[model samples]
Target: MVTAMASLPHIDNPVKLAVKDVAISYGGRTVLESVTFDVHEHEIFGIIGPANSGKTSFLKTLNRMDIFNPSMTFTGQITFNDRDIRKWRNVYSLRKRIGVVFPLPVGLPLTVYENVALAPRLSGVTGKADLDIIVERCLERAALWDEVKDRLDSLGSLLSGGQQQRLTIARALSQEPELLMLDEFSIAVDPVTTMRIEDVLKKLKKEMTIVLVTNLVQQARRLADRMALFLDGEVVEVGITEDLFAGQVKDQRTKDYLDGRFG
Candidate 1:
């Protein structure tokens, strides 16, 4: 089981997610296999890989999103809080605890305020006062509050691309998730917005474990404490982010990918 060595304080934190010998398939055709890793609490664990390497597919499996795809099949153990995810009786309950952000923002048809409040309301957090607090707090966490506080009643779809992306993050935060998984979140946003969101992520890791699957190798280096390099549907290496950059890697491909030689 190859895995990264955790950097201080974060190493002391308990594991928030664990995946062992995991494999994925589509219509019996294997896409990824023998994957294993643990995401420690309150830390950013990055997965860097080139396209079609199964990075996004792997993240979907963690939240059990496979249930929505009839052709997708998976085998292996995935656990959260030491309980196998496959053993969970309620799929929605599992998802609520593990939020996901896609490569591109998908804004709801509802108002800005409603988008952030929808999850809590569905979870039974009703009272207007309570909803207000939850909505504001989530927006604040996503760094969208100040920009849209006055436009709360506007439709989320009406927000600019960057604002909508942040709105997506705010909606995820509304779930009050224990683990947040972002799959190429900056793909559609501008560099400025990407940096802003990255800054927000740094602060957010203090509140929840984060799994960041990005194609940008430098982005991983800047934010990840520990990370894994995935290529051709395999994890080539896992180590402290700097250690990999410093050439402390078992696979030459790992250093090559990090150095922009390929990937």
Candidate 2:
């Protein structure tokens, strides 16, 4: 059953990520414009919009992933844990604290155990016994342990699409990130697998902040503590999920989208 945001207990958590007047551009064309929002600690913040609405573009900026593209340009400020991202001397260190999962699974051509262990190993976990525990713990959290525990030595790429996605998630979990971002996570996943991952996310929010960028509004409603609706590179509305769906939206465009009038 889906859990509505309105029914969830409210916690006065401190801000984990703050985006202020943030905008993104590529080769002189603006992708997102002047977006501002605060994601509270341990809350699931959902970003929803139609195609080309700049949702993914904005997600990339959270951990400075946009820097990989020379053509990408950013304006305004994005702060993580109250510190400006621009001042972070080691971008890798910043990324270590933030995990990201993309629309499709990109499993490395390595065994499932090796795939999940890679992150912890890079972080200096050298003891064999410690890596074993970390790998099993993360895979369990990803809802994949029961299915893959016996096949830990099997190549990750050989798994089914849904299983590969779960493996990718397990890899991300190995980082034990302060913030976890998922961009269209259900796109390639089966419905059952999606539901299983959703359950994992529900439990995960108790430990870390989450940023979910999805086109599925219902998914946002089920998982978000607060949501922002983006349209045509602009934020149309942002509010408690229930308020946005209660037919009393401040913006008519928001109501239109919610009512299925148009994307």
Candidate 3:
């Protein structure tokens, strides 16, 4: 059975991700400073902040995507599924368990079916029948199966902006990740499509943890079980979604941001 938003599990649930004193820098410039939080299993954890607040940088670190940058530096401990990420021998294997979707739709030039099947194929599932089932299941979970079922053979890049974003989500779901991170997923998506994806996320939380980085406070309020508010590279506050918005914040900055006082 799918859990409803109103009855979502409490923040005290077992932690899926534990970030302790995490800090990141590019070259000599600090991006995130001493951030710490816990993401409960099977819950939607929202990260909200203005541009350049290190929201995306933090998300990348969760999956070790920051390794692509030669100048990137990180300090502190990030543990996933009770194991320290820094000590992981296979970063690629770690990433396969943590899926990520970026702000913009980055659809591969391949067909819609291929786009969803690529990851599974890379993981060595080459059976045609198995790939077909995986592709259909992922697309259906992303709320995109019906729209693209007829055009599975069509190029992914040929889809509209909203469709392409959903396609990216389907591709991410294909990995069957233990945790899923979405960075400003609604930016390029239409309002209707955004709501549809949000519904998908609500259903998905029953299966895996979600880290949602969004600038829209209301969006966070609607989907997040709890949230951490970021400002100037710091975690200003973290608490239950309703309690935070109900004016039970720890810092003035948090209340200010929630009240539209400032970014």
Winner by lDDT: 3
**Per-prediction RMSD in angstroms?**
2.2, 2.8, 3.2
Tens digit per residue, CA lDDT, model 2, 37-68? 88999889999999899998898888898899
For model 3 the local lDDT of residue 18 reads 98
lDDT (Cα, tens digit) per residue for candidate 3, span 101-179: 9899999999999999999999999999999999999999998999999999999999999999999999999999999
Model 3 worst lDDT run, 10 consecutive residues: 1-10
Considering only N, C-alpha and C atoms within 3 Å, which residue pairs clash in candidate 1?
A: none
**lDDT (tens digit, per residue) of candidate 1 on 113-191:** 9999999999999899999999999999888899999999999999998899999999999999999999999998999
Model 1 gets an lDDT of 0.90
lDDT of 3 at 164: 95
Candidate 2 residue-wise lDDT at 2: 34
Off by over 4 Å in 3: 1-8
- How well does candidate 3 score on lDDT at residue 101? 93
lDDT (CA) for every model shown? 0.90, 0.90, 0.92
The residue ranges of model 2 lying beyond 4 angstroms of the native Cα positions read 1-11
